[model samples]
Target: MLHPEDVPTLREREHGRNLEGCCGPHGGTGPNLACPCGSLVATLLADCLGPWEVRLHPLRTWAHDPTGA
Candidate 1:
């Protein structure tokens, strides 16, 4: 269920990890996107491997856990 509207954003996030030697031996990018958007993109990349195997590691928003407990 990939959409043209999201392709650009997902691709941009992937490119963020193209730091050959600046970061790690194998640069890394995160799929810390919002809700279903991030999950979908990660699955698509993992299944297709068209660019990178997007790993889902979404950030915890205060809205979801205001107590932070």
Candidate 2:
């Protein structure tokens, strides 16, 4: 699980993707985060009853260093 602050490009998904919890989002249904280009990328679990974190989809993400370091 990744911190929401670690992924600044992801935004809350619309159309009920964040409607699985009472206080916040449970993130058990499916991807609830999208990229700047509007592509589903990860699931955000921030419900008041569970651990809060962002789970990224393995097939939808990768690591890179613009500095080539």
Which candidate's lDDT is highest? 2
TM-score for candidate 1, residues paired by index: 0.22
Q: Model 1, 1-50: lDDT tens per residue?
A: 34335545544333444323332213234332334344323322332323
Model 2 CA deviation exceeding 4 Å by range: none
Compared with the true structure, what per-residue lDDT tens digits does model 2 show for residues 24-60?
8988788889999998989999899988899999899
| Candidate 1 clash pair list | none
TM-score of each: 0.22, 0.86
Q: Candidate 1, residue 37: CA error in Å?
A: 12
Off by over 4 Å in 1: 1-9, 13-18, 21-25, 29-52, 60-69
Cα lDDT listed for each candidate: 0.36, 0.87
How many Å off is the CA of 36 in candidate 2?
A: 0.1
